[model samples]
Target: MSDVLVIGAGPAGLHAASRALDAGAEVTVLDAHDLVGGQFWRHLPDDRAAADEAQLHHGWKSFQQLRVRLEEHPRCRVLTGTEVWAIEPEEHGAAARVHALSGPSGALRREEVLLTPERLVLATGAHDRVLPFPGWDLPGVFSAGAAQALAKAERVAVGERVLVAGAGPFLLATAASLIATGATVVGVHEAAGPSALCRGWLSRPWELASSARKLTELAAYVTGHLRHRIPYVAGSAVIAAEGNGRVESVRVTRLDRDWRPVARTERDIAVDAVAVSHGFTPRLELAIAAGCAITADRFVAVDARQATTVPGVYAAGELTGIGGMALSAVEGAIAGLEAAGGVIPRQLLAERARQRAFAIRLERAHGIRPGWTDWLCDDTTICRCEDVPFGALSLTEGATQSLRAAKLSTRAGLGSCQGRTCGRTVEEILRQSPGLLGTTTTDQRPIAAPVRLGEFARE
Candidate 1:
């Protein structure tokens, strides 16, 4: 087994591996993607790469540095296309036993490797969270994350004309990516009203100055919007999408302070495609598998050194919280140093503190509101894979008292995706209903990662 085994190859994972190597440890990194860059640093292939590949991303140079250093290090082994299917929790603060498959999933043969590292760092990152609407299951309706991925990695526009709507700053980034891919963005509708934005942003003035670069990035986005002549509408949202086969148009509506739709402010906009994201939900399967303590807010709980409650295990990036890339990199550095048994620098801790305060501001500014569910109609689909509608969920299935009972009776989270697409939304919908007994948080999956049945036979 290696001294350190880091899961994920995103901004946090890449930096963790590099810092661990620098601390004189032989490190092994496992990433599911064929490329090292996680979702944030996703890019085109070398042959199809942009002349200035760095321009497409915000923190491109730093990602390049960390990736190159790790790849070129003698004590480092970077395994792309390696999916960690399970992490067997250990007692007495021992490293967790990690079971993974090394190769493409559809390959003729795949190798299964199990390792118990001396120190394990998990940076599994987060995924786009979408609120369900009437026509969300349609083909042209895409998550903002998937739309941005297609634009950045494939340089392909999702549609000729598009509309971006969501709560967080990520909508701006998604819109920019779409424009870069030559898509005509008609408008961006932010669900959070001006008061919510001010509470999250304008309340803290001096603290924001510490995050000048973040402001600069936001400015760049605004500048791009002005250049593209895309309208930025605040205090509004796309409450419903309507189309024949795929999404052909969306109904936009003005929202109250709590995101409830105003009665007479409904209007429609015609667009070929729509990208929506409420925010991000952390990927917690690996962290939970490692027996880490999760916070009430659903992020992995970590200490000052970025060490989890469980000894020999550390977590960074979005797993710890939904900060941007800069905060993720800082967290990664701290976790690496602590995991490698190296001392953390005072400056590093200071930077992390600064970044974290800004992360809090972002959360306040863009956190989801309870009234979002008011936008849903009876026919709205909650679990898309199983075709479970909001009305269906409201109907009493045999003794559906709790979240588990609802899942068992209605089969909402038991679809092909195993609740990845609709887990959080379903949980919230059931929790809001007074008919449900005890509202549970998101469901945990034991075999979270996908593995070929053939690989299981080989095992």
Candidate 2:
């Protein structure tokens, strides 16, 4: 059996490992979390397992089946609480050398492991992309991802009165989860308006059939919103959050086609908490370290077979693109089968194509618009880690020309996060500036994930 290392145990990784093992390969699935499921299937731990875990998630049963099968498979090794910190490229057709630490991250003792697998699969997934506004750094303002996660995994309400604001179908689900957690949802808001939605979801009606497979889930969220009498507002956003120290209320403003705020259309809404998300940003550090080709749009570049530019390396899931779970799983299956030397079935190819179209629709429907910057005042916090404001970036001021120079001068992305949270936003702020963009990109990090100095010394 050939050694196959899958660098995540999310939906994509699990499917990939299962398919690879079925094709007669030895698979080792490494996940950073304590459990196999990534964020999508995240739930309470076994000790505090939810009595109705299935209620919080959409595909709990299927996830359980695949997860159980992999854990018990003779040719599989599922390593939970293991994080790959770096990938060193090999010169002679060898898979990248993976450097990792395994154990409870907070615990004092953690074991380091180095593996040289013949094949590698990366499904590191994505993080929530929040376009910053004034007072976004406040305590009660939460990213849409964090809000849903708290409600789903911990059964914790973000606030007694919560307002869900963001683009994409995800806002509906977030509102549903908030309501489930006993939060009084003031409303559900979408940044994209009816026109964008029509262009994205209705323009190519035939292609939507591929995505319609999950329409039931969408319908359920919509039904819940209606049943609860939650107003669904479109073409609007929370322009500014306000409070003394934490968020108390937000200024909601109508936006134009380019996402520019419409004058005199702003209104203040009182809410204890604000849950917001514009879209998602792909996690590409592992792929970048593995020397895979990234697209102009910053996603990992993959072909019809899910092969990366680097030999013996494959990519799937959100890193490849912002397609949903079903798309990621299909890509994973294809990558695993091909990596294991199994011929991919024709139906998988068709499904992948359908999913790709759906991703395009998603991009059109709810993707971030350039005019989102209009939401930012000069005093708006750009990098929460560094507490740097928009005016400090000076993208249009022509003071510091390069991204690196600006980051250094203002200490924007050089903070504790190492740019994971604000790097893309800083880049976007630069992109809009035109003259501020430099050869340096915030995407590349020498260390994919955080490591202790001791861990680095061990390596």
Candidate 3:
């Protein structure tokens, strides 16, 4: 029997693995986290740790069930706390060479699995998008998803007063979690204005009931915010943050339809911490390194069957783009069915298409506003890894064109995190500053994570 290697343990990865196993392939699922569920449907220590159904999304409950189902499969093997650093396509043999590291032991490991009947699935999800503003480097600043994780997994409060700033569903989910956990939401700032809801409504009539369901979900969140008396500021941006050491207060302002912050509407809201996001950029290190074609969103581009341009490689979930967990699960199943040489169920394929269409519409309507680069004054830091200032990158020759040029000039990409946090922001700043945007593609590296030298020597 051929072995299939699925590189992720989230819904997409697990779904693909389950399909492969059902089709008689020996499947091994690898993940960086110790647990099976990815960020969306995390497995907390106990059920009591999480909030009631109203506050939390329903997917979390379903993911919990998925975990139990995956565990019962005989053809499946789960490897958690493992990192896939590099992958070499097979030319002579039918198998691909995968190089990875186990997180806890820091040991390098290698596996060569066949590529024919043994398919490769890239379900490596996404990371939160961060926009750099003054004091973003402050100690108390966290991503919106990070705050939910902090409370759910680590059992710690991010802060008493927190600012949740961003655009999209994650912003609402994060704010709800924080408020339910007793954190005072000082203010919620969204880059998109009332136009976002209008666009959502306009699309609903054409999309049938799907659009209405999404609208209702959004309305419920808005109602919760209103009931709690939490102020939701739409068409706004967090221009700057100020504090001695940690975050103290943030400057916010009204934004025009074109995303330019209005000059006269500036206001400063006091808060001990800030949780901000724009959207999510696909975590494409492994996919790009493996030579998959990337789209404008920096997500690994795949066809209807979740197959990448590279043969024998399949991709699913947020790594394809941040379409949420339900979409990911459906995409995963479709990918797995395709990988196993089985016909995708007609119902599942239709569902995937509907969800994909909805995701694209949402992305277009709530697209990142312009003038976000305004947050980064010349003095603001862009590369948090190396503490490189926007001024430094702007001055460096050819750094204004793209991430690749900036990396060449300032060593911006040469960091431990591999520019995951700062890459999108740098690209946006570069595109806006001097009007130099050559091509939109993620920087691909051979190794996604660091590997011990000894392992290489031994090989």
- Stretches of model 3 off by over 4 angstroms after superposition: 45-57, 92-95, 103-117, 206-208, 211-220, 401-405, 433-442
Relative to the true structure, candidate 2 reaches a TM of: 0.97
Encode model 3's per-residue lDDT on 171-208: one tens digit a residue.
Answer: 88788778867898887888888887468546556673
Model 1 — TM-score against the truth? Answer: 0.97
Arrange candidates, best TM-score first: 2, 1, 3
Q: Where is model 2 poorest over a 10-residue stretch in terms of lDDT?
A: 393-402
Which 10 consecutive positions of candidate 3 have the poorest summed lDDT? 108-117
Please say which candidate is ahead in lDDT: 2 or 3: 2
Off by over 4 Å in 2: 395-400
For each candidate, how many residue pairs have backbone atoms clashing (under 3 Å)?
A: 0, 0, 0
For model 3, name the residue pairs that clash.
Answer: none
Reference-based TM-score of each model: 0.97, 0.97, 0.90
lDDT of 2 at 54: 88
Position 1, candidate 2: lDDT:
64
lDDT string, candidate 1, 1-459, tens digits: 239999999989888888888788889998988889899999997789898877679989888888888889889999988888888887645588999888866686778888888899999999999988778889899999999999999998899899999888899999999988889999999988898889988995888898888889899999999999999988888988888999999999998887888999989999999999989999998888778889988999999998998889999999999988889988998898788988788999998998999889888878887888998888888888888888877785642477788788788888888898888888787777666677465547778687778877787
Q: How far does residue 292 in candidate 1 sit from its true spot (Å)?
A: 1.2
